[model samples]
Target: MKKLAVVNGKIIDVEKGSILQKNLFIEDGKIVEVSEKEPDNSWEILDASDCYVAPGIFDMHVHLRDPGYEYKEDINTGLRAAVEGGVTRVAAMPNTNPVNDNISVTEYMIEKAEALFLAELYPIAAITMGQKGETLTEMGLLAEAGAVGFSDDGLPVENAEVMRRALEYASLFDKPIIAHEEDKNLSGDGVINEGRISTLMGLPGIPSTAEEAMIARDVLLAGYTGGKLHICHVSTKGSVEIIRWAKKRGIPVTAEAAIHHLTLTEEDLYKAGYNTNFKMNPPLRTEEDIDALYKGLADGTIDAIVTDHAPHSKSDKEVEFDKAPFGIIGLQTLLPLSLRLWKENILTLPELFKKLAYNPARILNIPGGSIKVGEPAYITVFNMEKYTFTEGMILSKSKNSPFIGWKLEGKKKFIIVKDKVL
Candidate 1:
């Protein structure tokens, strides 16, 4: 086993909320020690001064677009993008062409990722077969084949009876049924959040109620079935309040606030007479909603900060605003944008680390989301400084970014894991 030591770093103790000056020694891909003193001259040393050493980010929501749709994104490029952005592990959504609803597809994704020796990538299988929401997937076997969780992603199962049974069956495996909470009926043909912006922009509106209605139903189903429920890309304040209350009532519910939702608003979509690049689903809400998103993160109403990093081909995004695909490539920009929160004094460095890494690991039952000694040596070294973001430089195959020229703060220096630099 190779041994390497990172020297002179400000380590973020997420569990303790303290920053310690320390050096970390890694052996056999695990952290053997973290000490205030430097290692004796035998091991390879990586400089970490002026960097905040913390656990690598674990993004619970992302679309690698492999198995099919390689033009949009593939396993290798997606993983490389993730590692480059300081994410060591990710749970890739299974809303691909074949959909990860069966054991063969699930195994294929897991095997494909392992063969590449890329970042730690786990697949979240589709909750319903083919993601049609008509028939349920083989949850038990899917979990056995290494599906970390289950989600239909872009399509929410609108039938309450189907969701209830899925929850009951999925609970037997102790895996979370990650729901994309949206009432399709209420959403209709809406492209962005239903509000004054939608009306002014002459676009159909997807009211916040579309999201809340589903979450409200899922919370009760999860409560009734005793299943763990995870709500993805929670953009509305009403949903955050529901999740907070559900947790208080002993419901096994967890929710994530996307990076964009915490930073941008629907007003950015008001670039007059322009084609849309700023549009995204759970469409960016008002500034008031952004504040609520931050509040959710601070008060523990939101359990994690997910990139919701959806990638689409340029041609797919070139169409009209209402017709174009709804998403953005956030994997590479998640940390820096989120760091804007830290630089602004909205959250301490340690607090941000908790939301980005530790807390998600706990809820997902993953072991790599910590900077603790003796754990797997998955860490991100980052620089907290002013910088500008650009699109073509993104490591992903797609270049669809809403924040393409944003002046952002903080950037990742390295993604360290498996006794090697990724």
Candidate 2:
């Protein structure tokens, strides 16, 4: 690999929550120097003028529907989407065809990602066998096979006993049980948030209690069992309060808020006139919920921001709103959408990258969340610029995002993943 230099950029120092004007030099896939001096003629140059150079983004919660659901998204296209979105490390949910419940499936995902050499993929194995919520899977064996964590993401673990066991078992391997918190009984056939909109539309509504109740239960379980608990896609004001309370008590809990939940509201969904692309599990809530989520991120109650990145084929999302699958492709829009936080002053640039990169790395115990000498050169260079997001710009096989054709800020100029630049 040729030595490369990134020059004339403002480097975000996430560790210190500051930015510095500096240049970086890389060789043999690792950062060889961080200094003010420019590299000589022998080095290849990447001009980063008028851009922010930050650690590579790590999206901890994403659904890469490989294995049996390649029609929706495969590893190849999924990772491609990831890199384009400036994400260099991704932790994929274990909701594939076979559910990623065993060693073979776990090994296959890891091997496939290694071969692709795009954004580093970390497989999160399922907490229960086939996600049935009855029996636990082989967490020990799966961890040995390179599974970073365990989750039954698309399906919530309804049984408290089962959930408690999963938390405890995952703790033994020093891994987190990433929970999809929802009380199915409360959520019951609901297509959107429970409020005026649901009543006016004459559709069943999913009350905030459905999510808050489960988060409450799981956090207490984590406290009792001394296990690591990570709540996924927290969507309610009540849920944020619960996570904040849990963190105050130091109950071994962490949580993430999805980009859509943080930015969009049920009002947007209603205005979209039943567009299935706006549909997602734990559905979009109100502006009140969005405000609470922003506070959660600002105060460290929410540790990371994720896309969920659930991709379904065009045919899969063309059905009636309630009948269609819940999810929208988000990989290609993660960075630009997330920059809204920084632009709005909810978080500074360094603080934003901490959630986007540093915190996720710490949660999953993975690498590539920081830039420093002697570390692998995983970096992203981007600028805040307005651009219209078009369907044609989507690199993922799926085209289900609601943000297409929307004017958005933040564009990734390029990403350096080890020795290769994309």
TM-score, one value per model: 0.97, 0.98
For residues 1-422, what per-residue lDDT tens digits would candidate 1 score against the true structure? 68888888888888888899898888889988888776777888888889888888888899999888999999999999998788988899998879888999888888888887767888999988889898999899999999888888889997888899888888888889999999999999998889988889888999999999899999999998898999999999899888888989999999998898988888887763334567788888998888778888888889888888888988998887777888888988899988888877878888898889887777777687677777888888888767777776798998888888888767788778777776
RMSD of each: 1.3, 1.2
The candidate that wins on lDDT is 2
Off by over 4 Å in 2: none
CA lDDT, every model vs. true structure: 0.86, 0.91
Model 1 root-mean-square deviation: 1.3
List candidate 1 stretches off by more than 4 Å.
272-274
For candidate 1, the per-residue lDDT at 285 reads 93
Question: What TM-score does structure 1 among the candidates reach?
Answer: 0.97
Write the residue-wise lDDT of candidate 2 on 1-422 in tens digits: 67999999999988888899999899978998988997899899999999999999889999899898999899999999999888888899999988899999999999998898898889999999999998999999999999999999978999999999899889999999999999999999999999978987777899999999999999999999999999999999999999999999989999999999988999998889889998999899998999999999999999999999999998999988889999888887889989988889999989899999889988987666777788788898999889999999998999999998899999888899888888
